[model samples]
Target chain A: MLADQVEKKAPVRRRKEARPQELTTAALSLFVEKGFAATRLDEVAARAGVSKGTLYLYFDSKEALFLAVIREGIVPIIEEGRKLLVAHADDPVRMLREYLFGWWALFGDTELGGVPKLMTSEAQNFPEVAQYYVREVILPGKALMREVLDRGVAKGVFRQTDSELVTHILMAPLLHLALWRHSFAVCCQVPDMDPNAYLESFFDLVLKGLAATPEGGK
Target chain B: MLADQVEKKAPVRRRKEARPQELTTAALSLFVEKGFAATRLDEVAARAGVSKGTLYLYFDSKEALFLAVIREGIVPIIEEGRKLLVAHADDPVRMLREYLFGWWALFGDTELGGVPKLMTSEAQNFPEVAQYYVREVILPGKALMREVLDRGVAKGVFRQTDSELVTHILMAPLLHLALWRHSFAVCCQVPDMDPNAYLESFFDLVLKGLAATPEGGK
Candidate 1:
């Protein structure tokens, strides 16, 4: 009876369960390597060991596949970060450290790092994709950073500043690292910069800069 | 006699004198807008109000034309900044401020600003171009900043730090602004950032971070 029950599970249903993830993982690599416009759906399917028709079953168009790749790859990390934000509400400094390090570990230090370069490179060519990326990824990410800065200011642990502008400053170096990794760093070796050391330097400078001074900060 | 002298200057001499600059100017805009791979030499020529054959007379290839655009547009600025560095050798803070603001004025707030974004976006597609850029522009630019940082540290005006890593930190936001202007900011409106105000914030934060503490600082 157990053998018959196992056999009853349809191969199509089991395959369908795993297909979308496989498709997106394949697409992400191609998009990163070839950039968005140059990456083709058939190649993605071939890389995933699926037929082009099967990739279409999961995604209507290449654009849809791209959106899925981004959403699947990054949205979950952001959601997890949001949850961590609530957990670290009482300690803004700790929250800030975790957030930055967590980003480095999750995005900057991973294969997903290429997404930032891909988006930055292709955004002008595809306004719709850029708009969607800004909405789904950029805005939420900035909002989370803004919250961290706002909490620090409110707690008197950090100097009063423009949270919006400061958030952008905080983001710049991280994005720079990611862009460098995918582009110039591909050809040129920057031997001295261990990414961890670079991040440590960034943290030291930024923390010192943001710390509320004993003499009233300007 | 003046009219006769002017007439004696061949039409070809006059045309040749101005052609390179005009071609570079046109190529710069198109490269910034369409990216390196997509931009055509013919379009650069047409935009410069010259014929395709005339463009070939000055620049043998599109790649050569691009290198000229960068060299013509930016190399002199770097050389000028180098001269100013010697003049400000005694005052590192002033030198730093002047350097940052000078960059903002000359590159960040102008069409040349688009070069950083262009380079970042297409560095992979053209490794030779990227190598030339790094050698010509990036290396000299970083060397100037490193001199400022080294001077500041040696004079005990700024805290001792890794001049190399700190230089990258210093450069990131400026690159961010340029990249943003050419990419997402083209489609997405960030209303709060007046470039001057943003730089002001950056200066404040960085200066504070870099300042040597009264208690014989870290």
Candidate 2:
């Protein structure tokens, strides 16, 4: 019964409906292989073993398909962030560490390749998609982080500054480094950098920034 | 005569050289308009007002042309940064302000609509390009800011820490903000946030990070 629900096949009783997720996964593979702009519904359908009619049943157009792919791709990255940040609830450093590791795991799928390019290239052109990516991924991730930061301030582990801005500062290095890693790792020429320790140093600097001058300390 | 040496097409240049740039720029318009894969060289040549033969005269393939466009687009951003940073040799805060503003200016350009996208997308496929972009543009900008950071540390404007990591930290927010600005501004329904003041607050936080303890305030 659990496996059946999990399978959630286009209920064999009805006109064929492609699973939104399965379509997304298939789209991911095509987008990675051919580049997003070059990918076709037929190609995605063929790869998914569905007809073009079935592919269109799920996504109205290539743009819509790409948007769904991105939304699906990043959702867990945000959701798990919410869960972890809430779970740790007391540890900003630990929360940050989990967030960094989490994003890498989510992006580790090679099929998600075109999504980054999509976010960077076509995002501006399709502001809705860009806005969606930012709203879904960035806003929630930053919000979760801000909550952790606010906790740090309450616990007096962090100095008082506008928590909102501080959150942005804390997150910037890790995300920037990750984005660069995503971009370069494909070419196999990325710097031999470790993402985990980099996050630690990054958090250390954030702590140093929020050290509150230690009363008599600078 | 001095201007002539710099401005004149160098005698060493092959006639084929300039055509590639023209082809790439033409293709960039098509890439931005129709998406990279959707664009054909014939369309690109038409956009550039050259023959199909003319397009082939310069570029061996679409991939080469696309890479050329990416290189051409980002070079100016880097060169402008170099000039701006060089001009503000003495002041780190001032240098940072100029750098952030210059970056926003580049990000706002509609000409290379797909650049950030290409950088991210292609990075997965083209690490060499990503390396070039980071080393040539990002590292140079970091080097410029480092001078100011080192000066600030020496003059008691900042505290002692590894200037390199600090430099990366100082830049993190600006870079993140730039990446998500269009989507973020609209999703959060923000008007363009003032880049200058944002840089000021960002650095103020940074300055606090670098402040020497009263005992260490040598």
Candidate 3:
């Protein structure tokens, strides 16, 4: 009787779990395209092939949906980074490079690339969502970089410097790339930008900058 | 009689010149605060201490006013940078450093700092404005940096690389800083992250990376 009840509930639970993810995914694209104030919940539901009633059942409001989109997108990435950290615990530079490139591959190169652009564009209007994102996503991402920098400094592989500031600096290029792509890239045409080349150059320059070296040796 | 007419005309000409500046200034602040789509021409006129009729006499529409605001803010800075380039033509490195710091002092430290943030947030909604900005402001800014980089390469002070890509890289941090201040700084608070110190660190790392050197050398 217990096994029969468990089997009967499994499909219902699976469908319930999948519905919110589909709604959030649809919402993310719309929000990124139209921005927070302009996007409507009905449109999100329409895009997701669901009724407004269904969307409402999952999310209390558009703000709640926005929060869910951010949370769902970021949490997995942070968990993945944590696993990467453990895997490369002994090599900070390698870990840093892997993490940066891995992030570009997983997030920046995908539809989720809109997240940074969305946050930067809408943060002022939605302070609560912004605060939640900062706490959940930005801070965790920064902390991951900080750990790598700290470990590098401790191991004498990287120069001693303010980890927090360096983390901000390191993240700037990636963030700018995403923001530009989502916002200005529509009209601001640069010939042959090649995102992969851009990231490669960034990694090269940043790692070289962080390398410990004798003063004026070059 | 001629002398009297010329004297009488002088103040009128001055007032004509100043009205547009004042109007643009008001529009810029409002656009920054509320964003382009949300800002009303009436509010902009009221903010500028002018009637709707007077505002319309100067600018045909809000978009026209936005264009004027962008033009008025950036043209002078570009002109100033042009003068700096001429003044520091001989020292590429010094010219680069001075130009970057001077930009921060002039634009980043003023109300004009909001222009970048404004563009990033609203560019998608206003394609024509974004295109004009790219054609007028961004291309010129990139050109200025490219000129500096090309000069450095010619002088053997900097390594041979893609000047365009390098220009984009150099600009990312400054753009990100302005964008952050306008958008996310409220919630993603980092205590003691001095703007000056951040720029200084950026300069240090970037210069180090661009310096032509042997492997493992400073």
Candidate 4:
């Protein structure tokens, strides 16, 4: 009788375990498409092939759902970046390159690309959400980048400069590229800008720019 | 009687001449504060110290008013850039530096700083506006930067890189700074970031990066 009961509940438990990821994935696409205020909970449920009741069980509110999406989808990518920083400890130059390219491959090139545009569009209206993103996503990401730059400088591969400022510079183009894709690229005739080529040029320009050499060496 | 009539008409003419500008300033602030779709016309008129009737006389619609704002407030700045390019014809480096700084001073540092945020937020909702901006502002700006890069390469002051890609790279940071100010800075405790210092670092980085020398000169 005990074995029979355990086997009967196993399938239900397995399906329940997968619900949050499915729900957050559904929420991300909707948030990207319709923005935060306009997207309805029912639509998210319908998109995820679940009922409104099921969504409510997983996330009490839209804000909670958004936070889960960030935690589940975005934080993992940032964690991977931290791991890469460790893995490439001795080779700061290669580490920086890999980290940037890895960001492009994992985040910028994915559906997650829409997050930057979403945050830019709605951050003012939702202060708590903005605060959460800054605290969780942006600050941590910047810290990771700062570590890379610091390592480079210490290794004598990069010039001594304000790592904080350089981190901002490194991120600006990538964020702008993502913002352009979701905003103007959606509505305007933004001539085909290949993302890979853009990243290549960015990497080439910035790496050469940051190299340690005599001032006015050229 | 003629002198009296001329005096009476002069003040009216002067105020009328300034109405469009006043109205646009009001509209720009409101649009930046509340995204485009939410801003109402009467509030704009009220903010400008004019009646809705006066607003109608100047602009037939909200869209027309936004275009006028871009035309009256922004176009002149880009035009000034063109003149600078010509004025510093023999000095590509100074021209590039001046152009970037002038952009920060004339546009990014002013009320116009909000325009980039406005466009980023509402461009998908207003395709015509985005098209007009692309045609009138972005393309021309990119053309100007490309010319500077080309001139630099010709003068052997800058490296041989794709000017098109470089122009995009050149613009991303400045645009990102403006976006940060209008979006995240409003709500978050973004430690005091000096705009002038940021631009100086950017100029230093890129100019050195673009210097034509043997690869890996460092």
Candidate 5:
């Protein structure tokens, strides 16, 4: 009876994640550093410590791999979801502050900064990357902000304004900052080094518009 | 004396505007409709009623010709340069109000609303175009606003602040309007279509920030 009971717990196997999956992760690390155009498959394979053929087993082509990296990398961050409304469910003013801070923190990360500009500058030509960039990154961020704005209106904190247009206005500074960071200021100084403080002024203006007790408001 | 000058000008060798210059003007009408990538040199020559060789006399390459079209075909309106600043130099609040009206009228023309976006997006990779964009287009606009802001602060109608950064914020709404007209609204409808009214809200926010009296501020 003891022998039978001991055998019953045996033969449990934890499946290892596939080698090809590991290769894809390795490819991404190389691509992000050198850029999609400059990165070579051989360099990727070498970096991954895999043969060229083994690398090809995971990604069919460099473009295909680049597309996958953006899709895999950007999607998760945007999908993490925003906490402005949920966290501050009853307070619209606090929620607006939190929302601005949320976007400011996201773009402050240089890794996050590069993706949108890199994708946008190349979007006119590469339809695939453009589609993936918008669907995964832009749409989700818009949705999160839209929810917060809707919450502000419903809470009677913000004016009964057009939520969609206000969402775009709220987004402009961040997107502008991203474009500046990745494109012109890659190794350059931001005019005012602390972007968060600058972004705060923008938030200050927008939130005041949404504020129920707007000072000397129309 | 005027009659004598006219007679002297009429008989002397008249300068011929370059054949390709003439051809480019004709080409622009077609290109605006068909787009640059789709337009052909031969079609441009045909439109100008010139031989392709004659068209080649001024602009040797397609890219050169297209650049010339962008350079010449697009320009600020005559009315745009007739700025009200000189008239209202002593009254900055009036200057700023008048200045904003100028921008509103110019941008509302519909013909010019898309030029800046098209040039920035399409020509960003080209160094010369980007330089021209930064210098001729972006800088002058900023300088004009800066002058107005400086005057406002001096007159105590506006608070003293970083005029350049303040100018950037002032233009943010214009950029937002362009985005809605061109790209952002592609995914969703633009709810607030009245840009002048939108600018009123935006300008009001800025003026409030600069206002000396804060008695009613919450």
Candidate 6:
């Protein structure tokens, strides 16, 4: 009986550890599909194939679950970015390009794409979550971009400019592209506005703008 | 008695003509403050100093009032941009700068700033209204920018590129700035981010990128 109980407990412990992430993944889809205010915890549990009681064991409330979703979605990306930054520290231009595209491949191209739209949409209604996100996710994200820009400027590969403002400028189009895909693209279809093409064009223009000298032997 | 009654009737006709604009202005504030789904028609009427019945006289439903707000907010800006475009047709670079900064002065600096945030937040939930907005506002707006870019490219003042994609790239940062002001700026105070300075920097980098040759004899 003891041996059988130990065997059962091993799987239960593993399942318990995994429950929070599974719940957040399910919650993210629902939150994105049906704005945050409208998504119920019961539905999240149902979508995750867990009971409401199981969800409560992990998250105390709907807001808690929403925060978890955001944190879970972003924290991993930030960690991956840090690793990429270290790997490509020697080449700031390449580092910058890789970082921008890497973000799209990991976050913008995935269901996590909806997080920005979701946060922007519901942030006003949920100030605490907004503040927390800005402090935790946004500031760190900006810091990472700023570091890359600073490195480029230091290397004299990029022009000397305000890294803070430039970071926002660099990010705005990409963020807008993601938000547009999830929001207005439903109504206003510009057939030529492919994400890959847009980002490529954006990077081309931005890199040229930042270069200390004009390309093409100018 | 007949002369007095006629005088009163003249004022009533003028007031009736102004009522729709006044009602939409009030509704715009409420919608921006409280959001679309949460805003009550009766409250909108109260804010406008009119009764619910009077609001219904101009707008059949809350959704109608919301559409009216969008239309009223954007239509004037579009008309003004058209006039600017015609006035500055000779200098595409100056025209682009004027148009970009003019947008910030007129729309981004006003209560109308909230419209982008409001629309982006609610567009998915209100597809018909979004469709109408795209038809009435967005496409025409993009056309104005495209004309500026085309003129620049044709004059060899700017590099040849996909104007459609470039138009969006140009507009995204501007739009994002406005949306950010209304959304995350409430909590995530990036103290260094002065809007005018940000736009100035954006225009500088973008204009530099588009120039047929690098500026400053570099």
Model 5 lDDT on a 0 to 1 scale = 0.60
Which one wins on DockQ?
A: 1
Candidate 6 per-residue lDDT over residues A189-218, each given as its tens digit: 646478888888888888878877635321
Between the candidate structures 3 and 6, which one is better when assessed by DockQ?
Answer: 6
* Model 2 lDDT tens row, A1-218: 35655755655433344467777888887676556665677888877766788777777887898888887776765675577556776676566566656655555334553355456555545678777777677677677777776776776666667666666666667666655555555565534556556655566656666664456532
- Cα RMSD over interface residues, candidate 5: 5.2
TM-score of each: 0.88, 0.70, 0.87, 0.85, 0.66, 0.88
Clashing pairs in 1: none
DockQ values per model:
0.54, 0.32, 0.49, 0.52, 0.09, 0.52
Report per-candidate TM-score of chain A alone.
0.87, 0.75, 0.86, 0.86, 0.75, 0.86
List, residue by residue over A7-81, the lDDT tens digit for candidate 4: 544342337888999999999988876676667899998898878988999888888888887778787787877
Screening candidate 3 with a backbone cut-off below 3 angstroms (N, C-alpha, C), the clashing residue pairs are: none
- List runs of model 3 lying over 4 Å from the truth: A1-17, A214-218, B1-18, B51-54, B214-218
Q: Per-residue lDDT of A1-218 in model 3, one digit per residue for the tens? A: 36664554434233677899999999889888877777888899889877798888889988889899998887788888778676888998888888778787877877888888888777777888888888888888988889999888888888887787889988888888887888788656656477888887888888878888866332
Every model: iRMSD: 1.3, 3.6, 1.5, 1.4, 5.2, 1.4
Please write out the lDDT profile of model 6 over residues B1-218, one tens digit for every residue. Answer: 45754554333233678889888988888777657876788898887777789888888777888888998888778888788768989999899988788888888888988888788778888888887877777788788999999999888888888888988898999998988887788756556479888988998898878878645321
**Predicted complex 5: DockQ:** 0.09
What is candidate 5's CA lDDT for residue A7?
67
Comparing 3 and 4 on TM-score, the stronger one: 3
TM-score of chain A of 6: 0.86
lDDT, candidate 6, residue B1?
Answer: 43
Residue-level lDDT of model 1, residues A104-216, one tens digit each, is 88878887888887777777877777888888888899999999988988888899988888899999999998888888888765454678888889989988899999677
- Candidate 2 predicts chain B with a TM-score of 0.69
